[model samples]
Target: MLKREVETAYDDPPAAETVNPQGASPYMLLCEHASNYIPTRYSGLGLDAKELQRHIAWDIGVAPIARELSRRLDAPLVLSGYSRLLIDCNRPTGVASSIPEISETTAIPGNQTLSHEERAYREAAFYWPFQREVGRILDQRQAKGTPTIVFGVHSFTPVFKGFVRPWHAGILFRKAERLGHALVDALQEPGLTVAANEPYQIRDESDYTVPVHGEARGLDAVLIEIRQDLIGDRDGQMAWVERLVPALQTVAAGALARA
Candidate 1:
């Protein structure tokens, strides 16, 4: 049994925002969990402000880093405007985690028992729009013969479910192994512990952007996850931008040379 689908007007910000849309760089940055806003129509999805602010609602500090990456790299970036709680742009539509009833240990009351129509509404309003935008960008680039690298920027909590993660950052990929490993090697600073894939892994069922827009199109793509604690402020975010921009440039150049 399922609850009657909540039929609310689709309002709030647009599903996606593009920055430096015409930038010349070969990289296209994505920040899927960029916001925590659940729209007033959903009434905060039955959670208080504190819960909405948690890492479960969104990636804590990846937006600034993504914006900086877009600025420094002169690359186009696409960022989701709504919370992952409404609909995760990074996740495939049919996955349980796509509209998580329980994110981490916190139960999402609004998502507990959604009807198919409710899920479809969210997909239509939030999920599909973002996916379409990304697809359009990639398609345009392909038509122009412009080489593009898709990079998803995200942040993970230093500790999750009472477990501590040691990596300062992680580079995740499935099909773009060479570029992924190259980024891993490049990000290995003296004081930083960079992992090839830790905290989470990329899967077609679990993820959308890389698989659909990047791998499907045969473009190099990888998701970069920085520890949330490290990028919680401007100074921290800038430090990572400084570290990542060059590494990405170096790798992008190498990838082009190899192509």
Candidate 2:
């Protein structure tokens, strides 16, 4: 029998949801902060429902966008099923953000004290499964001689720490500068700003997906962040979808071809 979590989260749904695993597109998408669902046992990590709904708990509105991108691009997508507060799927375990005590302006009451067992349990229950699946899929693709580039879809609050972010979208990369700048250029439009590595930067200490899953294997990778306000509703999501698909298509072809 598997080593059960001291506190079981759910029975039916698995930790990671994989869509279109055999998708033909060279791009692979990830939405690590996809859900804001903290198990009832955690009591929303000692937060009320309203606070749980904030960006501190999740990426706000990029999950559906990623799913749609998967369908439109015929690209495989992996989504984490739990809130980042429960355990951040994109953060390396044992880091402060792995189970952040304070997310932005609000302090997470439940995370203030944690036993090693609890931390380990959360990682085992929530984090590793998603990571393993990502690794497995990439391994399979590599064996099949497929050219795969990774994109992490995320959304950030338009105003963070009281300062308004000017860029409409950010393409963050560590080693894939060529592809990153190309994507920024692709998404640029009149009265629209697409930035390269603005708002947030990808560092091994701060992130896992692009650094571990993408750069580690020498794959071209980027984390795409859209201002949360832009993708808050169906119309907004579709608009971004329309804007992103073509740019990704154009950039991925050239990025992979050059590699």
Candidate 3:
């Protein structure tokens, strides 16, 4: 293997960046598909500029919202800096989607064949630093006996496989029912659409953020997914943020009380 076949440096932008690491709120946020940046060595993963901009590359318009939420909610947020094509921060290590060869319908040529060292390099450089930061934050909260509600912010394309999704947003949870249901109900207003566990669900086998950092520690964890089309621009991102900030603030007390 050539010396440049795999990741060897931190690059210009690190694999992950954290905001408000010492935030006071119990709400800890994670944006796994926050960026679509592919290191120069990957060479766009054999993709054109257009495909790299697609949802398969990253969760469109989520990083900004998560950043704002970290501010408005006074919560600490962990954002992965690289593209999901390199390795998905939210996914468990070695899963199919973690380093997807085919995301949605588009094939990732650079990911087609990877060696043990290459895979290991990506995990060390792209994955662990993010997950460990999350774990460290959670551990601090646990030791301090501080209340915590783990939330992962994500986005999905409005259409997949020729089917259109109806809900504008979905709150996914496995054990944090009280907090998750409260959010789903709150987002349900006169004209808005919200559901429980739509788009995706949390599975220990596939998911890492909530399952390991939240649930494993007995903390209430939930995954909040918004429609990518709804948050594709600045205005759309703010609207959803205005909607979610209040909902999260409202249910937080009850969730923490239960915990």
Question: Clashing residue pairs in candidate 3, if any?
Answer: none
Ranking by TM-score: 2, 1, 3
Which residues of candidate 3, in runs, are more than 4 Å off? 1-11
Q: Please write out the lDDT profile of model 2 over residues 106-172, one tens digit for every residue.
A: 8999998899878888888889999999998899999999999989999988898899899889999
Query: Against the true structure, what is each candidate's TM-score?
Result: 0.95, 0.97, 0.95
Candidate 1: worst-modelled 10 consecutive residues by lDDT: 1-10
What TM-score should be assigned to candidate 2? 0.97
RMSD of candidate 2 to true structure, Å: 1.4
Residue-level error in angstroms, candidate 3, position 171: 0.4
Worst 10 contiguous positions by lDDT, candidate 2: 1-10
Model 2 misplacement above 4 A: 6-12
The C-alpha lDDT values of all candidates are 0.90, 0.90, 0.87
| lDDT tens readout by residue for model 3, 35-95 | 9998787899999999999999999999999999999998999999889999999888888
Residues 1-259 of candidate 1: C-alpha lDDT, one tens digit per residue: 2233334445667888999988889999999999998878788888999999889999988999999889999999999999999999999998999999999999999998998788988898788888888888888888999999999999999888999999999999999999999999999879899998787898988988889888889998899999999989899999999999899999999999998
Model 2, residue pairs in steric clash: none
The C-alpha RMSD of each candidate to the native structure, in angstroms, is 2.9, 1.4, 2.3
- Which residue pairs in candidate 1 collide? none
